[model samples]
Target: IADQDEHCKKFMEALIPEAFRKLQCSHPIDHWAGWL
Candidate 1:
């Protein structure tokens, strides 16, 4: 279970940046940065 959790964490870390990059392309970074 711990190994699965670690794998998920690593996957999310990789995925999140790509997701953010897509979002930035569709919207303005400043808009989302304010929310963050």
Candidate 2:
């Protein structure tokens, strides 16, 4: 978002974070005892 492209920022902001969230959410490491 620090770049000069407003359109790119908005498009990437919506798309990139969603991809990472799904990737992180699907990871099975959350089930571990020290996961806290």
Candidate 3:
């Protein structure tokens, strides 16, 4: 249905930015930094 499509779109738009910020803050390199 069109309503489901619209809702999914809105949910993704809301989620992507927060996911991006968390991805940015999550530093994988920091884990290796301690070994060096």
Candidate 4:
């Protein structure tokens, strides 16, 4: 369970940035509005 958790954490660390960048590029105004 701990190992799975660690792997998930690493995966999320890598995925979140790319996902966020895509979201930002695809919807800049909406993303910023929701983020803010």
Candidate 5:
């Protein structure tokens, strides 16, 4: 449904950034700008 799609979109918007930050912190190497 449209509501589910909206919810998934928001959830991903929320999670992806934090996850990417954690990933960058965990691995401090080349291409770290992906976190920002």
Candidate 6:
């Protein structure tokens, strides 16, 4: 269970940045910075 949790954490860490970048590219609005 602990190993699975660690893997999930790493997966999310990798995914969020990529997703955020895509969102920024698609939107590119100033208010998007507030999401951080």
The lDDT of each candidate is 0.91, 0.81, 0.88, 0.92, 0.88, 0.89
RMSD of 4: 5.9
Error of 6 at 26 (Å): 0.7
Per-residue error for 29 in candidate 4, Å, reads 9.9
Tell me the tens digit of each residue's lDDT in model 1 across 1-36: 999999999999999999999987878766778899
TM-scores of the models, in the given order? 0.68, 0.48, 0.71, 0.67, 0.72, 0.72
Q: Candidate 2, residues 1-36: lDDT per residue as tens digits? A: 556698888899999999999878877565664587
Which residue pairs clash within candidate 4? none
Q: What stretches of model 3 exceed 4 Å from their correct place?
A: 28-36
How many clashes show up per model?
A: 0, 0, 0, 0, 0, 0
The candidate that achieves the highest lDDT relative to the unseen native structure: 4
Error of 5 at 29 (Å): 8.7
lDDT of 6 by residue, 13-32 (tens): 99999999988787856576
Runs in model 1 deviating more than 4 A are 28-36
Tens digits of lDDT, candidate 5, 1-36: 999999999999999999999987778754565766
Compared with the true structure, model 4 gives a TM-score of: 0.67
TM-score of 2: 0.48
Which whole-number lDDT from 0 to 100 does residue 22 have in model 3? 83
Per-residue lDDT of 26 in model 2: 71
> lDDT of candidate 3 vs native?
0.88
TM-score of 6: 0.72
Pairs with steric clashes in candidate 1: none
Q: After superposition, how far is residue 24 of candidate 4 from its true place, in Å?
A: 0.9
